[model samples]
Target: MCKSRILLVEGRRTVGGGQIMSRRICDVLSTNYDIAVFLPDGESPLAELLQDYSLHRYPMLEYHSGKKGVSDVCRFIYNMWRTCRVLRRFIRKEDITVVYVQAPSLLPVVVCAVAGMDVQIFVHLHVVHVDRKVRLLLNVCLQQKCVKKIIGVSDFTLQQLSLKNRRKSVVLYNYIDDCIKKTVSSDTCEKPVISVIADVMRIKGHHVLFEALQSSALNVEVLIIGRIVEVDYYKELIDKKYSFQYTFTGYVNDVERYLEQTDLVIVPSVGFETFSLAMVESWGKGIPTIASDLGGMKELVENFLPQYAEILLFSPGNIEELKVKIETILNHDILYREVSEKVHEVAYNNFSKTSFRKKLLGII
Candidate 1:
């Protein structure tokens, strides 16, 4: 049997929920396939995070400008031409079997702009929030007819795409390794700790969490474990004088450590995401999360996160209402402990590495 040459494409520096999902699947698939990855050209931590696995890597053009009324047609053409040079070279050298790319089309619609080729292409549609422009792009991808498959991280993401893309879509939930799964322990201490784990991007709603904490009547001590993705944004939040009772562990090695000590995982997102990997990770840990009512989260209620989902619902951006509910949750220890004990089994059974690998193999 010939080795399947797999080409994975991503468009970010730091790892988000969807990217992490893709990475984990790729890591497991790497056992048999000859793997390579094309990330956007920049200094991203994703490049380093992927280093542990044996895979070839490339960096494509970071910008994708077209009919959105771009200033330079020549520059766009030049980038596309440059991309063709690299992709063609990779195909020949690697004897590529399948190309797995991410959605909202990275490499700046190069695949769509150029004529279709013979290499089998699979697009991972992680876009849960579809505005007018995004809907347009996926339509273009569907029209191309070169795309072989579309993997939606959740059903919510599948519905956002056109009927054509939907026809080719499949749902493969994100997962964590056994190493991490074994470490998913609930906080057994008397004082429950609430922690938020995510990049400090404006879309992540860390600021909203601060507001939620300030307004809450519960005296819960909070610890945040994530990278300060933007220096300016981090500075802005610190400047807001709401920094009390919050410890920012800006980008650390192990997230499981924070999860080990954390009781309540707060997922306050102001924007949409295909699937929340951190939320799944928390579920894997048997630690309940309080997430926003918006985005794909509504459909992805699982493990500990799902158990707490009922009380965690609040109007998007409504901090005052969030505070009131949070206070109510914290005050009720009997309910908290009841849910906490149940998640331990759910987290391991549903999201362990065995299940993740089995699902991937079943699909492929």
Candidate 2:
């Protein structure tokens, strides 16, 4: 008997949680299906790791942070049309029966390409969009007959869709690497080390974290991991007055190594966050986190560690509240150790690679 064919599509040109999950899906599905990866024509960690697979690249237009012009609109339209045409042809030629689109930006074109075809469409959403226009377009596309399932990284992500559109949706939380859990150690430092593992964007609330740390009397150091996605934002962060010492390690491939030294992880995202692999990975290392009580971060803590939600979550962009949470963890050693152990157990039981692989295989 011939195995089924699956085309996994992703639009990002960078390495993030979404790209990692896409790679995970490919690895798990390849056991029972012939996998083909569709990506933007560029050099990225995902691209390099997936070279051994059937990979296809195209000149894809990505939605980034910028002011849109008429020329930009025209270019996006042309690219969308071209991408749809190319994808439809490829699907037909390759005899693909299942199309798994991993990014929301590529959903419109993918929906159009697979419309009225015999193929099944699975859309996996990683980020939560706040823009009304973007949400409207996504809702329309998801309502199509070909879109068999709308998979959200968290339940909060699926809540953003229309009631009618949500009928075909399911929540499949993202998971951390199994090896990360092994890095957990019974380590403690005199001066607590709080690390924020996210790109330097205003939406990530890096300045808010710095401001909170400055007000605290306790001595703490910060490790700002990931690349500076926005230069202006980084400049603003550096120019601010903060008493706590902080270092920026621009785009480190081995993030777990840094987590090993960290006592606490802070996720201060003011904007919509569907899910945070950083927080999960930190937990897998038996590290406690104080995350902004927004979107999926709140959902994860409230659902998984409900008794510790008050200790783990802070109001988004609230300097005083965040400052208090950080101090609370650092001042009490017992509380810190207890939360750490609980998070490690949660990560192992809920966010393990084995659990994710089993569920994904069943979903597809």
| Best candidate, TM-score | 2
| Candidate 2 C-alpha lDDT tens digits along 1-364 | 8889999998878887788788878888888899999998878877986787899887786665434456656766977899899998999899899999997788888888887789899999887776666778889989888889988999999987999988888888887775354333333566778899998899899988899888889888899998899999999888877788899999887888898788889999998788998988888888899999999999999999999999999989999999998888878877877888899989989987788878888777
For candidate 1, write residues 1-364 as lDDT tens digits: 8667777777666676666666776778787786777665655678677776544444454433223325344444555566656666766776766777763555344363334556667777777534466467566766566676677778877887777767777887666664243333233455558888887877778888788877655556678778786788888888876534678888875887777777778778888766777766776666666778876676666423565567756666778877776666566667665655555556666667777778666555
**After TM-score superposition, what is the CA distance of residue 24 in candidate 2 from its true location, in Å?**
1.4
Clashes of 1: 0
The lDDT for every candidate, in the order shown, is 0.67, 0.85
C-alpha RMSD by candidate, in order = 3.6, 2.1
Model 2 scores what on Cα lDDT?
0.85
- After superposing candidate 2 on the true structure, give the runs of residues whose Cα lies further than 4 Å from its correct spot: 66-72, 179-187
Q: Give the Cα-based TM-score of candidate 2 against the true structure.
A: 0.94
Candidate number of the best lDDT? 2
